[model samples]
Target: MVRRRLVGAVRSVFNDTARGERPVQPSDEALFAPDTPIRLVHADVTAMMVGGVAALLMQALHPRALQGVLDHSNFREDMLGRLRRTARFIAVTTYAHRDEAEAAIARVDAIHARVTGTMPDGSRYAAQEPGTLAWVHIAESWCFMEAHLRYVRPDMSPADQDRYFAQSGLVARKLGADPVPDTRSEALALIARYRPDLRGSPDARETARIVLAGTSRKPAERALHRLLGEAAVDLLPGFARKMLGLRRPLLTSLPTRAATGMLANTMRWAFGR
Candidate 1:
């Protein structure tokens, strides 16, 4: 009965929005918006959550997944090749902001150096050197979007989303990278240029659809319940309560020590800690 009601509510919300009516404001909206410093912080939090969950799941199921995904033997060479290709794309599109673009490229170089503890083989990595300024302008802009979208309103009108994407592509091209692709792979590839070592087999086009869908329609609370069913609740009652508190905070609280223990228990349940 509860699930049915929740589904009905979600459908009603979407129907209203689709018909140009104002949907009910979620209680959390005031706390989460596109243009706040808190949004950036939230994005960072979400990234950490995604990374941590991925690591935990992979470790539990197959410890070798990491090694297989990041096969070190050809990793550097492959990454350098991709970077060079990306640099060419940036050169043509980001010409107007050449200096800023090159700085973005340098940032990627620095990230590479930190990751590998050595510079990529210059001879192996060499492509026609594009203007440094252009490279920075492109790479940094891409980084900004990657970091920004995770926390900000990932849902915008289709027209606005397209405009924002185009502006990002322009930044990339000005830095000497090729024109950005309208497809999901193109966006993922752009990100890969900076962090080639990170590998996930997520389909770019599917991801784009998910992002758009997530933004376009009202999110179904039933989906949340499905993800956190009775098994999840029984496993860590305290943490489960806190999650519930997110929707009804006035009804839940714990002593500091108990809250700490609940969090620890939740992580342990999640990671076998």
Candidate 2:
């Protein structure tokens, strides 16, 4: 019965992403095959959720990015709707047929075209801009891999990491993020390079609160939501932690790890094998 409920919860998280999307089915041979690095890297549902939230928080560290989200997104009224859209895009582009992936990218690109406006200082920000897109892309890929390393597979080889970074660039480039990094070191350098431009603001904090405030109708699922939220905070970069004022006590490490493992294993079991 526990497994049955877990199966439903996990399915809702991913399958529902396609709710309002134009259907995109995977080919017999999807973009990433079963044993490919991309498949191996992103197959864990729990790690993806934990890392995805961490990435969202990290992305908002950029003032312009946060401003763009605040100014344009309907996050207040429909946070889960936003998350489902994002998840759908990722799912279609990564796992679906090439035509489906292209369709998803076209839809996203059209949305991004309208995601432009002026910042407080009168500087302009557009989601499609190279720098802005790169930041979002890198933050997402970095956090997802970080979560995979910590919770799903601690022993992920360095070469595999490099390949994952390199291959992920395919999607990033498609999204118009030029000069995406090709290796782990470059990925870290990309983050470091943007430090001067990244900082916490009221927008960032508010977004974090909204992300953490995700509640489930089912009581069993509420614990899982909190676990993912806390794990996201714990896995964030020290600078990110400081920016968001999310400090993790040293004593919480073991407990955090234990909860994360449970979440990961539970999802894996529910999904099978």
- Name the best candidate (by lDDT): 2
lDDT tens digits by residue: candidate 1, 207-228: 2122212222235533422222
Note the Cα lDDT for every prediction shown: 0.33, 0.82
Clashes of each: 36, 0
lDDT of 2 at 78: 78
| Model 2, global lDDT | 0.82
lDDT of 2 by residue, 1-273 (tens): 888887765566656545553434545566665566777777788888888889999998988777778889987787777777777777777778777788878888888899999999998989889888999999999998999999988998999999888878898898899769989899999999998988788778878888887845677667777778889998899999898878788998779889889868877888685
Model 2 TM-score (2 dp): 0.93
Position 24, candidate 2: lDDT: 41
Error of 1 at 17 (Å): 47
How does each model score on TM-score? Answer: 0.25, 0.93
